[model samples]
Target: MSEEQREAVLDEALDAAHVDAAFADQLFGVVDALDTSVALRRAVTDPAASEDRRSGLVHALFGPRVGEGVSGFVADAARRRWTTGRTFVEALEREAVRAQLRAADDDGTLEDTEDGLFRFARIVASDRDLRTALSDRVVPLEVRQRLVSDLLAERATPATLALARRAVAARNRTFDQTVEAYVDLAAAQKNRVVATVRVARPMTDEQRQRLRAALSRQAGRDVVVQEVVDPDVVGGVRVELGDEVLEGTVSAKLDEAKRLFD
Candidate 1:
């Protein structure tokens, strides 16, 4: 199935689970099972397989082992059409992250966990060697997990650690991307989208409010602006909302002008 269709399936599954902590752990177990088995991944996600066969495979493997609801959730996922095996797996990881975030939300520590993840991502982004170490496929998964634990042991909440470790364990995404995805999931739980806004200088509260309102209107969803005060920003602010970028910075405009002249 297309990416949109895959997400639609996930949305249904999440909606059914609501705010259950046990469901999240069950979903995480399903993700762990899939991540460890290449043959299993192929069997469930194969485009040529009939939906019945896919659903049967999920039931046969997980029905006796996992909770009934969890098995049903996996079976539902298997019945969906995925464009590729990797896409199916990535969709599963997204659900796992969402599940954990839901648990955090129930505990009232979700905001802290979300901010902690963003801070950790920024830390990883700033260190080239650390980023390489975390994202390197050559590194053993245990080593990477241990590294994450070491770095976050005291600084992060248990939910944050669990989410981060699971992201790395999912093994198909870069550390930065995985953490960012988790952050986005956290934002979604709060009914908002994250818009990275870079400005030459710090904005007043009024400016921040107005910019967020404008972005919310444009995206047709509530937007939470994560402001970055960039010393180099010129002309205006640069807004990054998902894949769409609005580059109103002076440098970008000057570059565009040069291109037009050429």
Candidate 2:
């Protein structure tokens, strides 16, 4: 019910000797199934039902369809307490993305996958038509997925492509938002915090290194910088790390000075 409880369940589900792309795929399949079936979602998260009973229901419904690993994971998750069926489904989805990113990490393409997701998100954010097409439920789901695949096939890693297609589902969020969430998860797979940095110009390798190091020290952890070159920043930099924002941009300073005068 609490965030800690949910995180505990997730950590337990992911605690394995080895996690592969197949495992991630299986989890995604389960998430899709639960998301589409309201009755199934309710059945698994029913408060009146005993934990074992709920877990049994999961095994009965998915045991034959999914592999043992995923079956066990789903059953275990069903046995846990969730605030709502929607939260249960979201937890599964989050774990699926984490597992997929873990696979990319294992394959040494984690950075590529993160960059692909970030770049795709930026592209979608800039193109209104592309965003509409991807997020429009009126369009066939397959068509939207196909469009994503076609756009990223050559540029993205397999993990990135898989996540991009999943983003088209968009569940409760926008397409770009879902991709950004995946990008954050990718950074988490490496035990790094994500810092979205905006600047008037691109940073050189040395500048990037220094900024990353400074952020890492400030956060008390490794930090991955997702740089956005925004001319509106007009010099200096703006760093968004989770809820905290560090603004040193010329525009921000000018705004402050104008406010004082006014």
Give the candidate number with the greatest TM-score.
2
Alpha-carbon lDDT of model 1: 0.78
TM-scores of the candidates in the order shown = 0.80, 0.91
The predictions' CA RMSDs to the true structure, in order, are 5.2, 4.3
Q: Give the backbone clash total of model 1.
A: 2
Q: Which stretches of candidate 1 lie over 4 Å from their true place?
A: 18-22, 46-50, 170-172, 200-207, 234-237, 248-262
The lDDT per prediction is 0.78, 0.84
lDDT of 1 by residue, 18-130 (tens): 64567777777777788778898999998898999999999999898878887887788888887777678778767767878888888888888988887787788778998
Candidate 2's displacement at residue 225, Å, is 0.8
Worst 10 residues of 2 by lDDT: 253-262
TM-score of 2: 0.91
lDDT of 2 by residue, 70-152 (tens): 88888988888888888998988888888888889989999999998998999999899999999889999999999999998
Winning model by lDDT: 2
How far does residue 79 in candidate 2 sit from its true spot (Å)? 0.6
lDDT of 2: 0.84
